[model samples]
Target: MPPPESSGPPLIGPLIAQLRLARRWSQPRLAAELCAVSDVPTLGRHEISRWERQLRVPGDFWLGWLAVVLAVPVALLVEAATRTRSLGTAPAVVGARSRSALLALAQRWLLDPGDPSFAAATGWLPPTGPPTGAGAAPPTGVPALPPTGAGEPPPTGVPALPPTGPVDRSAEVVRLAELRRLDDLSGGAELSGIGFSWLRRVARASSEATPVGRRRLLPVLAETAQLCGWLAADAGAPTDALEAYRFGLRAAGAAGDPALAGHLLGSASHLLASVGDPHGALVLARTGYAGCHTVASPRLRALLLHRIALAAALGGRHQPARCALAAAQRAADRVEEGREPPWLYWVDGPELAAMTGRALVVLRRPRRAVALLGVGQGSGRPRSGAVYGGWLARAYLQLGEVEQACAVADDALLDAVRAGSPRAVTQLTAVRRGLAPHRHRQPVRRHLALVAAAGPYLPRPVTGSRPDPTDRTAPPVGNGGADRPGTPARRGPGGRTGSSVRPVGGRPNGGRAARRTDGRAATHSETG
Candidate 1:
């Protein structure tokens, strides 16, 4: 890649990026466009990214095409490129020692999250200036791992360690399946580190695997990346989640599987929204659907539509959210069993209900959110129940049923901690924030305290959850803990409702789900 800045009007790269972001286009989408129109499919996101950073300027020939597509005059593009660049605008490049240190620390935390030493990565600061005279190489990352012989295994329980030989496609599939199940049992806080390392190992082994094995492995890589993204989102690490999704996109494109690529796009769209970039999220949602709506399976299309609707809801675009929601319903109804991909098992009735309800809650149609999400109260990931509880709490609060909302908030708090879910924690925070008006009330204060006191999820080995999708035998991660705790008496679906609560007017969502940089979801609503 070229340096981020260079002299003169020929600085075509940042110009491309500025225009693209202005149009809400992802780097991949623009790259795809270039590839489509080019004589030789020579460029991709890497090239587009390079151009934007002024790392390597695109030739004038491509610049003209980009200008036309960007709807900017060639003269304007040239003008922007000619301006002197500031080094401050360039991407931050960490020292190689820092990079190694960060990666090692990340890997260590993932494999052993509960270790108190995780404080290092969370708090460590770089040296203010240059390194000291003696030993200053980022603490010589990973101080004492057995540096194994040529053929021996590295160590037990140490993830991301080099494998002894080539990985087969089947092994990667099995691992992906395992990781997905683990994510369902817990969240990314418990699984991301290991899953990331697993992928790295698979990637390293790819060179040794046969051509046929590599082909099969690519799609698995894509899916694994999505799984990691999901984990990262749940754990409140949106950047890491998005990184995983981007990797998924690249792997999916290389694998030549539109379905997988579409899923990655949709999943990433959701992540973008979760991270508070609703407009960017909306753009990705549209891009995902546009790319695959025609040829994708009905289930896949429905998934994409759900993402679009979710992003719209988060962005407070009620009409668009509503339209997408309706389209998602239609697409969902058209799913064909054998035609849908195995990875889509989570996108069933419960998922549909949750997605719809989430949008509605944001849209301020809380009553409908309660009705739909409550009906499927027993579905989706194990920990989603906590999220459902929080959503229901917000809906109740809207209806002035303060007691019920408090009750629901209390119910979800334990699950939030048990599952280590940042997403759930976010919902709980919003629930508390909304209750500020009723702070004088004892119940509300107690609930607020509960929400505030809830700490990061600590992973305890779970057992007897859903049966492993790939393996016939039951997974060891069971639903025996907080997940199986006696069900709370919810007010929606089978339960009776309070008199103060108003009925939902159809299915409009009303609020923006603001995400903190740390990955917690917050409510950002508008009165449409």
Candidate 2:
């Protein structure tokens, strides 16, 4: 096997490290976990450390072990290892056709937790948005939920609200509206981690807090699923997010509401694109947008096409990206503010500018990126605002304006910290790494220290890997230093690598996502 140069941590290493940390398992424990699942009599913690440190790949032989132990897609594990290896080597400069194939397999891990066909995506076109309950199918692994008639009723003492009375239904609606407003203020998660756990709690609460017929229940579930999906991705949990989206989709279908279903699927597609699953994102976006086009207002259609453009650009489909972008602009031009959906208030001009700039950056058109991303810098929405600021920093870095990048990075660090976005934090760290040659300078060092204070998993400084003649594919040699992947390995209990490290990331900031300063994909997977 060709060993790629390790200018930075290979894909497998940091992910192994992060996933292991998420499990709160020490290296030895992970090794043991592997052993129990593997045919190999035993694997050693030392080897696991090597894998995390990018010293040696376990090859395809160990993917099943790692996948089962980490509870992630086995294909994803392979993709990580492959990406890291590719980076260590330089791009061979393949054709567009070959490139798209590689891109599809990049971070496009089929996230449906129960989709047996997860890794079997055919040409990256996923199920398009189907009208809910119009022969909508459940994921392969989801056990059929019982009919409400056969389902258990609430206990006698359990709380029950009058079914769909004007006042009772309005109470739930009031709470939902409040949550949305508060979420905007708090940057997505509040009332305890806007994530899978929180979503579950809310779902349970809604189920028990009110008694209603299918009419009321479906919309509630759809809305809950939508928020939960966002939160799950926000907290760096893609699989969980995918599950939430699928459930929300089901609810929308059951409610026979194309508006809700289209919105949910479109948003999910946007998240996928942001997370490096652009093909899946594109497919989902197309599915949802097509259905919504006739029914949704022009502004909403623009938002939908905006997401599609982003995914296409990231996937290296320049023509499609450009076409979609143009279409989105045309749609935007035709917008009628009065006819907007409740959720589309956030999808205005500034957001459009930001998304466009982001797509430009991924396509490596830095000049265009700089202009638009700058406009996006002060977006009031904290999450995308922080990300847009990061993009600004990256655009500056690409133009070789180190000082400007530093200034923007500092601003981004603050916003990202407030937004609790791990990806933005790491993107900022990559800026620092790009400035490694100038680390002797005060601004870089000062900023690095401040970023370090943000959280435990903030990127630690790392020395460059020694060059290897055999691996010629790594990106053009940088300051001879780059941000090495993996948490600093400290010996933890039982002589294992650090397990106390926390996983960090906001939603996969993939579409309209900023690349690291060195022009590498910020990450194909999680950020922190």
Candidate 3:
């Protein structure tokens, strides 16, 4: 293994550390496992330590073995290594701890704009800085915003603002809502950079406005943060999402809008649940619901309850999960058009049905899940369709309906590719793992091939508990939970399956017809 020509801060080292820590493996253990898997005992704990400390770099031989043992793609490892070699003597890439510190500083800035610490925390800010010179090219990997003529709305999805004037709060609110609607068509990966840019603009505006103007702008700031966080999470940038949520929570607090704060908490909870932190998710969901129960609209209440239900199911609190789902449904039934917040325009009956169906699937109630998931698969929304369809396919697999599962998974894979949603891809990845035992079947093999073909369009598999494609004993597909892949499903109370099985389901809906509306009322046609 030849070392790089020039010294640089470790890029691949942190990634390797994260992967090893995620599996709770010590340096010696990882080294031993590498030797065992590759039938080469030349590497020792000292070598592993040197690689992790950036004192040495792993060459092709070690990289291949690491990829095989870590269940990560070789391309990802090579990219990290390549970056280190290219950026000689560059500062270290930000690690998780640094990211968390920056996020905390951002939240604090939102809480107290006059705080001095806020000024120092701007080093690694989002790509929201001033634009480059006219006709100059944008930096690599950052998309250039379209130029707009004077008096025209900004070519960016977010609206433009004057340099010095009283801000038009109502107009800005409407524009923000419009910007959010774009996410339904094009998933967050494409819009996250734009969303962060908008947020930076809003934050600057808030800082410059008068006290009265600042108060009005705070709500807008909170709303923008919420959207940015959602986009970041969808783009597989969980740290960015968390920062946005924390910032939004502070903005919501400053604005005295507990309802919006609750919404932010729920959004954060959803992110937590997606990343395999069910207990933390449940706590946040419950806290959010408790704080704003008196002020939240029926739809908002329903959304919070739905978050709680999903978190509970994922955490294996079956009874509370079911109860929360029932409450969410009742709240949904009571939703009054034109009374709810505009940001929640997407929380219609079908959406709730889909959410409930997702919970039921996690709870291992396949019979009940199929009917609800069938009704809730988002009409004309490819991302939502892919997400719900993935769950529906899982239900079919649970019921021993291989052909049906393959058919549904096929549609889901297409939708996932079309939508370009990492979340949808993650769901489909689980479904693929579940079908591993049935790979001998023609349909399963075809579906697996399709998934492989779509790999370029999809995000890499996440770091935790990824099952080997050839491992027939891989755990059943469920919501990404704490259970490691290939671990046997444990029985819980009443002989119910534990976290190893996806936590999802709801009571049977008795074949209720799905209400097919455009999600929002006619007056809010622009809203999602």
Candidate 4:
């Protein structure tokens, strides 16, 4: 029977734990209660303890019943078991497949949560501006902005309120959940709007909150706002992104989440650099460095400092850039696996090296950029793949290798499609731009068209110069990202997170409603 066509080894431990956590039950509590209810004497505290810690597997019958109790299919359990066995022999395959499965399973749980109809709806284009049911009176006593000293300027160097008071736990959690949902569903359009809304809401909610909640929710709020600002920039809304980041910086500082604040600042710096404001990016990175020192985790510190280095390089500050890069290397080298924070999950040596390589490219060293980013050239991982493709395209174009540049551009374009991220979209746009000098050539032109066709799904292209009209404003009300294929009157090419195009000029001060080309509401299946 071809050795039962082995699929992979089981990733049973984590799968079981994830399922259990989704149910929100303690191991001992479940053991005692389920043992009595299921009439399985063997399924006692000891067995439950062992299972939770991954020390031992339960018997076959118990396994089947446990799957039911956890609301996980029996087939999934078998798949995990097979993976575990295969992992013992083929570790690489097992690891890759197992990680994919984990992420998939988590996404599923997040989407359905065991009650699909009762979920938060969380359409790709969420209601903008303010949430429903928010109490009236602007959260009485809440400080709108943080207090500022006479000589201390705000992070954005704009006159704004300084952060104060504690974060409201309930309100903050709701806001984060909303932002996270939007992030998962949409690409970039609503990122800034929602982020800005969240900032206003949280700032108001936290006015009279306590110290404990403030500390806990501050980091979350900062991260949320930073993501908003970053996405806004990716959508060709640099100014909006900056405003979002500014608010996020204050929240991060107020909550004492120095590491998180540093990371947000780094993100803001990257946006600044992308929008021909490298000097601004450099300043933001330096500010981030000041905060990075307060973080306890080496991995977090390293990642933040890496951003500083990249920003400085883009800003033409060679000495400080090199110094920051060296510090980042040292900190990264000192970080131990499994000890880093969640945000630093994807920031590894390779990712950092890619950033440094891009910095080299920006500093007019195309050859070095290629060398730095070319590590793990054949790896399928999107993060490294996108960066390598970008650098290669730039390098080949700089060397006047027209054919090679086009080839690399094609690869980068495909990578952007598979990765489905704003960062990838931005990098791939660099590849497209590099090939623009040869735009008349068939291969380059064709590739550019393909990239443009994919535009609706991709993040809006962000140029360091003037914005593209398609990106600067939403399509006419009747047309939007969510238009159906072959729908003549729809007015737009594609849909992202069910977003309908916003009208040009001006709309309502509150969030604009999704509309069609004829200035009417349009609906698609994905909106559900």
Q: Please list the residue runs of candidate 2 whose C-alpha ends up more than 4 Å from where it truly belongs after superposition.
A: 1-167, 187-212, 436-442, 456-528
- Flag the better candidate by lDDT, 2 or 3: 3
lDDT of 3 by residue, 1-528 (tens): 111111122256556766786788888899888877655565577656545544334554567667878899877876766553332221111122212222222223323334332222222233231122122233223344565557777654434432344557887787688767878866565566667767777787777777778778888988988998787667655555666776776677677787998898888778767766565566567767766767889999899888888878888989888888888877888889999999998888888887888889899999988998899564888888888888899899999999999999899888877775566776777788899999999999999888878777763211211121111222222222224546454433234343211100111112221121111000100011
lDDT of each: 0.54, 0.52, 0.62, 0.49
Sort by lDDT, top down from the best = 3, 1, 2, 4
Off by over 4 Å in 3: 1-167, 459-528
Q: Give the per-residue lDDT of model 1 (tens digit) for 226-265.
A: 7766664554444455556655655666566667766776
Q: In terms of TM-score, how similar is model 1 to the real structure? A: 0.61
Judging by lDDT, tell me the better candidate of 1 and 3.
Answer: 3
Model 4, residue 276: C-alpha shift (Å) = 0.6
Per-residue CA lDDT of model 2 for 1-528, tens digit only, reads: 110111122256657866887788899999888766553443578667656644344454466557777898877876766654443311221111112222222222211122222212211211112111112232222122222232455233211221332324456555555555555544322211323333344344444443344346557667767766554444333443454566666556555566676677776676666555565566566656654467778887777777777777877888878888888888889988778866666777877887788777777787888998887666565656667777777777778887888888888777776654433454565566777887887878887777778655332111121122112222211111111344243332233332211101111111121121211122211111
**How many Å off is the CA of 158 in candidate 1?**
13
- Runs of candidate 1 exceeding 4 Å displacement: 1-49, 52-163, 456-528
Counted clashes in each candidate structure: 17, 12, 13, 24
**Residue-level lDDT for 375 in candidate 4:** 65
Pairwise TM-score winner, candidates 1 and 4: 1
Per-residue error at 189 for model 1, in Å?
1.2
- Cα lDDT of candidate 4 equals 0.49
lDDT by residue for model 4 (74-157), tens: 678756544433322101101112122222222222222242211112111211221111121111122123435656664331
